[model samples]
Target: MLRGQRLGCLSIRKGGSVDTHVEAVLAELAALEDPRMRQVNERHGDDHGVNLTKLRGVAKARGTDHDLALRLWATDDTAARLVAILISRPKSFEASELDSMIREARAVKVHDWLVNYVVKKGPHAEELRVAWLDDPDPVVASAGWALTADVVAKRPELVDLPGLLRTIDAEMKAAPDREQWEMNSTLAAIGIHHPALRPQAIEIGERLEVLKDYPTPPGCTSPFAPIWIGEIVRRQSAG
Candidate 1:
């Protein structure tokens, strides 16, 4: 558990013989304290959870070492490196690792890649969708949900977009203070693009009351409120 300063390393519970894996890693690191190790570790710091590419080979040589690298990626800054790993070595990360990657990716490009790859012809679309909704960053979650809506609209038979919409709705309801502007914006875009989810999007907009308290971000006007008011006015006049 990560509390204050000391990070608990991964351990195994086998017959009460507990092992502090990180201590063993430190021992190995002490032995390989050469400039060559430093250079390699730095080169591939983003991967293999270390600064050197030499560590990659070394980690690969030992199962325990590989687990240590994964442990580093499990719950911290090294988690960001999982994005790089997914891009380069798609098959490297396990399910938990992908979830960790989603949690750590705060950039738009990271969401873009994850959305695109997960929706492709693969066996992990459901996992990807779950990751999208569960992501800590609202922007990433919104992008993921929007992508799901888009893919569902395009190929309705493959996945259930409506169900995911309900999921989004449920999340919004559950987290009253969750500011999901980016996710809402993405969903609005999806609504504009997909006919099926437009009505649902409008309903969601109504539920959200976007115009009631929409904050105009600095240097930017409100996107949804104006469009929402205009659409309502148009319909009223036509009626």
Candidate 2:
């Protein structure tokens, strides 16, 4: 069953046949934690073939072996492993383990696993992040801030948008300011997701001037801010 042919046997297109194959695949996948296999699965981009429900079952079968899941997942393509991790939601890992995975994975790729699964479900998400935000290490804090901003942009209601702007602003000000390019990149991501924050952000340009000088990267600029702001202002003036 290690070969691709066996995996094909595990594939079912529809109806009861699909259910049976999914069950078999989940069982096999749960038992097999070989990082090499995980890597091969990712290289082959077979994650799309996986049914989420079956992946959840496999994770459930694995029980509390979260570390095992992480190790196996680290070897796979980031996107596929992300889907697997979300399904598994494995618990009972040490704090160090999750933190290590977060740091490691964040650098390799800005995959959604950290935001969706780890931030949403992992036991140490809050604690680790709380510590991270105040970390003396700029690298750690910047990474934490970048991830936090990314997550918050998706669920703006989860945070006080104004407060976040201030927090990020304060951090940027207090830091040595060596990584202007990286900082702008992160800010651009925020702008893409939360148009409402743009006015406040654009205001920062008035004070720093550098913000205005920092032209948005070509082709990556978000229209959300311009569009939403225009509509709101237009309606207000009409009223």
Candidate 3:
């Protein structure tokens, strides 16, 4: 029983076993925290210190529990939300709920996991994608572009490729960092996936020069769109 404990609007029950369950899960997450891990994750703008491998282990133990997921999410703790995303039934959440969640997820890993593991698998993905694309907030808009980039990679027929390139060409250089990263991804995807559009994609990437000099560790691909596009295309052809 969590007694008087309250997480956001959720009232922790006085004597109920459900509160105990949430308490236990949170305790487990707390136990996994490491300062070293937090420092590494902090570099990427994620707030939690729990090792992801251990966090996923916790989720596997809990399995899918939408009710628990909601409770965990209401806690607004980054590690708990990661577990919530893992155990959530993606299609069960309303579009508005997901919209709110994304906006509230300030931590980078929480935002990324919520988008990739929950929202992307939900029925409202395309709806949210459209709604979020033009959002005034650049971070929210970045998620929109992330979804758009996914579509460009896997379902190219559904998007206006030239329009996307035009947007990237005109706006990417001035776009905020988060939004520009995903926009660059979309540009790379267009070049890699569509042979006919490859030339234009490469040209746009070269012209924009976004992330052109990004420092990438050896053995990993660069995020620079022109180089990323070329390397991926070369790999595909070689394969």
For TM-score, the strongest prediction is 3
Candidate 3, residues 1-239, lDDT tens digits: the string is 00122235464453554597688889999999999999999999898899999999999999999998998898888999999999999999888788888888889889888889998898988888888888888998989999999889787777888998888899999999988998898889888988899999999888878999999999999999889989998998899
Off by over 4 Å in 3: 1-9, 12-18
Q: Name the candidate, 2 or 3, with the larger TM-score value.
A: 3
Per-residue accuracy of model 2 over 1-239 as CA lDDT, tens digit each: 00111101122334444444334434465554456655555653333333445555655655544444444454444433543465455355555655555454532232334544565465655556555656665555554565565556565554566776675565554454322323443454455455676666655534443334444566543223333334445555699
Each model's TM-score?
0.41, 0.43, 0.93
TM-score between model 2 and native = 0.43
Model 1: CA > 4 A from native? 1-75, 78-87, 103-123, 130-150, 153-155, 164-171, 174-186, 210-239
Every candidate's CA RMSD: 11.9, 12.0, 4.9
Best by lDDT: 3
Residue 181 shift from truth in candidate 3, angstroms: 0.8
If both were scored by lDDT, which would come out higher, candidate 1 or candidate 3? Answer: 3
Judged by lDDT against the true structure, how good is candidate 3?
A: 0.87
Question: lDDT for every model?
Answer: 0.49, 0.48, 0.87
